[model samples]
Target chain A: MSQFFTAAVLTSTVAAGIALATPFLLAALGETLGQRSGVINLGVDGIMLLAAFATYYVALRTDDVLLAILAGMGTGLLMGVVTAAVSVTLKAEQGISGIGVYLFGLGFSDLLFQKLVGTPLPITTPPQVGIPLLDQIPVLGGMFFDQSPLVYLAFLLVPVVAFVLNHTTYGLKIRAAGENPAAADSLGVSVARIRWSTVLLGCTFAGLAGASLLLYDGIFQVNLTQSEGFIAVALVYFGAWRPSGVMAGSLLYGLVGAIILTWKSLGIIPLSGSDLAATAPAVITVLALLFVARRFRQPAALGKPYEREA
Target chain B: MQRPVHRRALPALLAVAALVAAACGSSSSPAPVSSAAAPASVAPAASSSVTPAPAATAPASAAAAASGATSATTLKVALVAPSAVNDLAFTQSMVEALNSIKARYNLQVAISDNQFVVSTAANVIRSYASQGYNLVIAHGSQYGSTLQQLAPQFPNVSFAWGTAGSTFNQPNIFAYQANSNEGGYVQGAMAAMLSTSKVLGVIGPIAVGDAKLYVDGFCAGAKSVDPTISCIPVYTGSFSDVSLFATAAKTFVSNKADVLTGTAQAVVGAIGVARADNLPWFGTQWTQVSLAPHNVVSSQIYNWAPILEQIITEIRGGKLGGATYTVTLGNGGETIQFNSGFNLPANVKAKADELIKGITDGLVNVPQ
Candidate 1:
């Protein structure tokens, strides 16, 4: 424990935490937007898996990182469209439909991967783009600025997402559709359109999250996101549908996960109980959610489909 | 003015289903639910946790069985592995061994890869047994209980499984194991010798079977090389999640580990990290030099042919299982194949050769 407290160890752990947070922050930001618009796509993990595989396959063929990321976003866009159509236009149960989308994404991605790419191969990852002189600033630059472009992209989207959700006419319409769909419809604002937009954007972000995770390791395996998407869904709740809150939740999870990993590496955690220690991030996040649950109220019209009256 | 939402949306949902089904149709691997290939009685073992590989019938072997060209000489074998055939770990080792013996024995082989779900794997095992496959290998320890139930039902078919030495005292049930500890011992000794910082990191996938044996042997061997050497291990608690293994590797690298090694399929992720850090890596189960050509020191390849061939011959000799077989450094079941790519010092290479010989000759104890 004492050795774990060293400055070097702390810096390394925090640096890892920021890198680990990229996927969660990216996914949760999108989810936050979706939830803010009264939509909850439970298949974020599935979307990530599908997108991750697409990104991997594209990278394998083209050796182009940017193209691979686009491929991921495209896969996510398709999945998002599926999710939006099922939940919005089709008026299927959002929870069940989202799960259906997830199952399809999960199974389909795996099927495609096995069929197309039999073995897991390494691909070109997004090289870390350090912010020059800022990166040389002792521990801070390494902790925050010296990360993959995907990480920076994820963090940069927070402010953009916050602006879209809190300011502007589009943001107001989204809040209205989520909070009082009947009123929004009465005002001639298309609830379905707003939701479709949010779901599309959010799911696209989920796709970016998958690409980021792939870039993190530069490899793809079955279910490579490994419930990180599900964790992103949880983070939407942990964040209470705010971009800032989602960022904090993601960082907390990442930090806790990094600490546990650091402990395992340092042999501070016993071999027998290392598994239990590994569960710390999920456990702590869940506990935090429980504690934070009472303070945050969901949108009143959330999860209720708006069927316009004749 | 527009079409009804439910009426219009029905086609969209059907289209989605059709697209998914179409992709699955063109899949090279077997659809997740392999009960499609098995008889009607094989329950739908469609598990969501992991997808099973295709029920691939080895082309030459299948042709031989179809023609009955050499009825007396042909041996039909079915393999039900817990992971991908190309996992570079347990399943791949067995598949390679089976492939090695396939031509020599005129064996017809059928494979059901990625049957990680025990219940699903059990159904595949039973389907193979009922189909009159001469030998069915349920290749995971998790399938032990399933074998106990199914092996009794098929008295004529010989069932084999391992990385374990338990045959459940049932006739027609064969258990085989790899004394992976021996090779692991050699790997750990080599890693310790090669490591400059004397801090070696080990990654394990959930501490089960050979994964546990290999890591335990590694630590013991490392300690033997230098009593004061540090060989701490991190168990990633998953076999499929590459990111977890990568995270474990990054942590190891950050902690000043100059040498790295681990077990199971996802260890590729760790090997990637090792390659990035330019650290020496020891591998097991199958040759991982392809994953990290320059970084890999040597691999402990599980040549299951020696033990598996012994079981096949015993079955031919009218001894239908109820025995355990083990492959070791002594029995030629496991071997150390060093990578020609790495610039290994002559002294270190000689020491590794000596360690292998010492273990093969019972001079070294790979104990925890």
Candidate 2:
């Protein structure tokens, strides 16, 4: 309806939609790379949280945004490696191990925040920077062009990820490992190394997603990544496990978020029904999963742990 | 020997390196909390002196008091709330209050935000207890049952909470209740008088006990003023979803409602709708009027600083936790703050002032 789909509403919706999608896009794209190397990281959410709280503390202590982001990435990489070592080397269940990593990261990061900042502190975040010409264009300008640099990176990552996965030799080896670890191992490829590296790379992206949220929101509150990790998981499936598809998925989710925000901003949708629209991303992801399940095939050894015993 | 050297030292070195790298990262600097609180007893002193209130940063006095009361070397306090510490409204206020107390009194405080997960509640308590926390305070009404169960095991540690008239019997556990409904009633009275259309709407999160107090108090306050006023209420059953709050607000505005009030945290969405539609609204807990300066008529502000400072002072003093302390209008626990810049009608201000006096005097009872 024109009432819901007004130009102002659409543009704002797209902007907010992208903002909401950055975390999911970054996490899912990272996961896609990991899965390609036969490593499934369910701990993406936990890793994001670890990065978020760590970044918050570091930023609070040092007042450096770049350092915070790097800290987040490093935390994510460590979490990824832990999950990878247990699942890839020890042959532990990937899903279970990833869950453990998530739980640990959440509790550990939260404790660190409590210890450092003393529960709640009034901290001010950096202002978002925009390019000169693009940021001033009415609706799209403020929404798309005048965003935090991480949002643009999320979009840039889609093609970069596609190029890496589809064209690069490392990408080929990762795919080979995911498709048939034993065959790849027979070819003298260290399946363990590939899986560990992929998971760490994915975790770094996940960490970036967490950083985007804290940096953009201007404050780091508790449960800062509430269900965002689940959304990232959903994006992986929504994108049909492809980098381009994941980007589309993030856009769709971000679009819904932006629409609800814009519609409310314009007084188009009544306030009572706005919560339903907020549920749109999660619901759409579920529905998209159903569609993808029927249309596409998941990697053969997606969740199975790789062991060298045989 | 070679394997042992790589295994033992490398991971330790990496961990240390990671810790150093992490220590260097992050953005945003916090303002020093010198002016965050002005003691309740003191007059508005000089403008720029960063003196935190006596209730907030009286560590020397608290230390003297604690030494007189107990021999405990470390005073540990834990915060377990239904929502995250960054909720920015109810829970955030509590967290800030507790942290201020901790900083002033030099008490060790641990906070568990999403302890809304029932399984995690007991686990969190046990972990904190194992670490020898002296006092634990749970923020939401939902944690009443959880606190009751855990208080016995950690008898040496005191547990306190804000619940709906819920009490803990353990020598160590206490409850803290506030005159929240009184604040709700004031907003109601304000919204009732300010409405141009005499039709008001409320978009609440859920139909819970505390939320019901807000809704019922608002309705009662409105009815006390205008016998012929119509009030609409809707519970969307969620707090985090802002779009829903907005949609409800738009509907109310579209339906000729000129005033709105709600208990939903995401009610910011609803306020945005009100601002865009040019209808005045009221908020709760924090000064949400800052969101839409023109549209927000008034906010019922809750002063957690007083309650927090008092509890911390009492602990530092010779007193073991008292049976639940309930703050009322007479005690300056809660008050309705109007946008002083807004030129509200004289009659409206007079009626609100009269009601506040009556409430403080116990002549008027706000419905809960």
Candidate 3:
């Protein structure tokens, strides 16, 4: 317990928390965009799985992080297009269709992995790039600045996402599409187009999220996402579909996860209940949702497929 | 309007169906490849009377002689694993063991990996048995119930499954388990002695089966070295969540733990964390030194070759089941492999060696 109070321990915990949060942040921010446009994509986890495997495969073959990331994003784009085609163009029920996408991603990724990489092989992770002056700052520097390029980009996306949603014509159309797609359609906005684009954008971010996770550990296996993708989608509701709120929710989750682990390590939590301690993040998420559910107004036509007049 | 909806929906649904069919097609294709490699000599009736030549027969002669006139009597074994054959963990250990004894017994080995789903595994197990394989090994504890039900149906084929001790008292079923606590004790003793902060962390997959035994033994071993040494054991409640493992490992490091260890496949994530912090890591189930040579001090490798040999010998002697095999320090079934890359202290290595000897010699009784 005394060890938990030390400066070094606190700094590392913060750093670890950020590392854990980055994947969720990226995925949730993407989900936020889609939800704002009224297309709910529950297939984010599937997207992440396929992207993670694709990214790992490319990185293993080419040894180029750029190409690997592009491969990951490309996989996501492919999956995204499929998802859009199903829920948007085909007018299927969004929830059930998303599950289909999830199962496809899950099974397809496993199949591809078994066929391509039958065994676990180590790949070099992208090297960490510390900020010049910022990394030298006592505790905060190491916690925030001394991270991989992916982490910096995930955080950067937060503000970029917030600005776009509030201040742009495309963002306005997306919001309009979600809140009242019929009205948006009446005003010459293509509701289908807005929803399809938003879903695709969400999936692309999900793909990037997968690549970030693969880069973090440098290994891929079956179920590597471990439901982080599902949690990211849920975070959309937890954050009220707002980018800033999503970031806060993601960080809270990351920090809580880090704290529980740290507490268990220091014996601050009893060994007997360690399994229960692992459930801290999920329990907290549920409680946060319950607290905010009453006040939140989700998009009116979030899951409805828009069919323009014939 | 209806026609347009139908046209768009048809192509989308067809695309999804085609993709799903491709996945199923690829996953199902491995089964036939395994079944196709089945030896021609394994007659359906011979499976019931699979009594190999006496143990005194030179095992090398068996392979050569079997290829000639005795091919009808050669052992054909099928292994169904829950994960990839080369997961570098539980499944891999059995695969390597099977490979080791393949040539000596004139054994034809067939492997079905990634059988995480029980129904799929049951079908595969039954398929192997019905195909007249001499011995079918279900290499996961999750398959225990399935094996219990299936073992009785296949009276002619010898059944082996583990990471467990129960054989259902069946005549044709063999059970094997590792005395993992023995090696865990040794690892804990070394970590206790070498930890600079007197803190050690154990990232367990779940508190059941061998995982529970290993964690209990590890804590006992640490306390034995220094009664006050802080040994924290945490179960992530999952065996596949690499992110959770990494988080747990980082937390341990953050709390000033200079030594860490974990079990199961997820330990790869924990090992990566240990490497990043330059902390010493102890491993179990397989040799993990390859994963992080610089940080992995030692690994308790599960050498199931000896056990496999014994099982084969018994099957040859017409004694199929009603027994259990345990891998311990005394038997060559489990051995602690120290990493040459890690600069372990001389005294710490000596102490670890002494502990191993003591456990093997019955002077040390590891906690259950």
Candidate 4:
């Protein structure tokens, strides 16, 4: 424990936490957008898994990072389109349709992987780039600025998401749709369009997150996302459906996870105690949710499909 | 949407997430490592006296029996495994060993694969015992306690389990271990020489059972090569969580580890990092070249056939159980299979061979 407090260990652990938080932040921020626009994608995990596999395959075949990223986002966008078709246009129950998407993503990705890449193979990873002067800072810059570009993008999107949700006219329309779809529709805000747009964006972010997982080590396997998509979904509630809150929740999770991993590595936490400690993040999430659940309100029209008056 | 009013929406979402997480967690094995398992085949009947068990009765064993040349004296063997039979790691070693002895011993094998949950596994173990299977093998050390309880209840039945050297003082129990340290020590000695930075990373499932011994031996071996060599071991506390394994590997790389090695099936994740970083990886449990052909230096292959052969011979000699067997390099139970594709330096290979010979001939001691 004393050694864990040393600057070297602390910085490295914190740095690890930040790196680990990238995928969750991206995915959760996407969830925040969808939920604020009267949509919830339960199949986020599925979208991630499918995109992860696609990202790995493309990277393996092309060795083009941009093309691989686009391919992954394309997969997510395609899945998002299908999800919108079911939940937005067809008015299927959002929860059930999301599960269907998740199942599809889970099964089809593995099937494709086995059919295409029978064994594990490595791909070219995106190069790590450090911010010029920020990386030069003694310890802080190294922890915060030195990472894959995806990490910077993920963190930068937190504020971008907040601005879009809190300030833009489109953001107002999104808020209206989630709070009262009938009113948003009556006001000619096009609830369907707003919901469609948000869900697509949410899923594309999920795709980016998935692609980054592959980009991390250039490896893709069965269940690559490991259901991180679902955790992101839950994080939406943890953040009170706000972008900043979601970012906080993601970092909290990552930090807690990193701490545990470090402690185990340092032998501060015994192997027997590690399992119990591993559950800390979820336990913390639940407690935090329970504490905040009563304070913040979910969008009134969230998870409901709207049909305009004929 | 309003049906779950604002007050309850959070709880509702939590419930949905919980359900999704539960679904993911309930997988029989940890990951897709077992996706390549051979279709369960039945033993062939060698004589008119051989009768296959009904498919509805014990399907897996029935298939094994149907595929074998089963005779009247054939032994009914059941394997209770925590993962898929072809997981390419621990369970695969035992399955391969069992397959090797099928012809000589006339064993009718049944496998209950992916028994990770102890309660469910206990039920399957009980099922095998009640079916009067001549031999029941609980292949995970996690099942030791349950086996100890079950072994006494089924006194007439013979049982075996391992990567452990304990029979729980039960006369009807057989225990086995790979003494994996011998091979791990050799791998570590080679890794130390291979490293230019003199820093090494190890990914472990948990520090217990065979995992602890192998890691301890590895650290000792590296230090023996050069006392100043830095070899760090990190346990992800899971045998199947691939993401955690990857994270551990990244941490090591960030801390300047030049070479990597790990145990368990999930080590594929670490191997990926090693491949991406172009670092050599020493693998254990099985030959992992298929995962990272270029990165894998070599692997410590656990060949349990000889030990299985010994146990079978002993059992056939009127010994029900009460034996603990350790597979050693000298005993022909473990082999260091170097990857042919890897461009290892001549001196490194020679050093590895020298280390192997030393351990085999009992000239070099592996730290316990």
**Index of the highest-lDDT prediction:** 3
Query: What lDDT score goes with residue A117 in model 1?
Result: 88
lDDT of 1 by residue, A1-310 (tens): 9999876787788888888888999999988888888898888988999999999999999999999999999988988998888788777667767766776777777778777988767776666789989988887877787888888888899899889878889999989988988888999999999999999998999999998898788777766787899899998889888898999999999988888888888888888897778778888999999988789999877876667766
Stretches of candidate 4 above 4 Å error? A1-12, A89-100, A132-134, A263-277, A283-287, A305-310, B1-88, B91-139, B143-161, B165-175, B193-198, B227-229, B307-325, B340-351, B363-365
Could you give candidate 4's per-residue lDDT for residues A183-295 as a string of tens digits? Answer: 88788899989999999999999999888877875677666776789999988898999888898889988888888877766667775786677677778877887887789
> Which of 2 and 3 is the better model by lDDT?
3
**Clash number for candidate 4:** 11
Report the lDDT tens digits of candidate 2 across residue range B1-368. Answer: 00222333344344434433453332111111122232233321111112222222334355345543442334667777666555546666677666655544455666666555666666776677667766677777777787778777777776777744555545665666666677777777877888778888787776565566677688788878887787757665566445456555644564557888887456656666676566777777656655667777777665665555555545555444545555566667667788865677888888888888989888898876
State the lDDT of candidate 3 residue by residue for A186-268, as single tens digits.
Answer: 89999888888988889999999999998887778887898899999888888899998889888988888887877777778
TM-score of each: 0.89, 0.65, 0.87, 0.79
Candidate 3 accuracy as lDDT = 0.81
Q: How accurate locally is residue A68 in candidate 3, as Cα lDDT from 0 to 100?
A: 96
Q: What is the lDDT of candidate 2?
A: 0.67
Best by DockQ: 3
DockQ (0 to 1) for model 2: 0.09
Task: Give the residue spans of candidate 3 off by over 4 A.
Answer: A1-6, A127-143, B1-4, B25-71, B74-76, B117-134, B149-158, B170-172, B223-226, B313-320
Order the numbered candidates by DockQ, best leading.
3, 1, 4, 2
- Backbone clash total for model 2 is 23
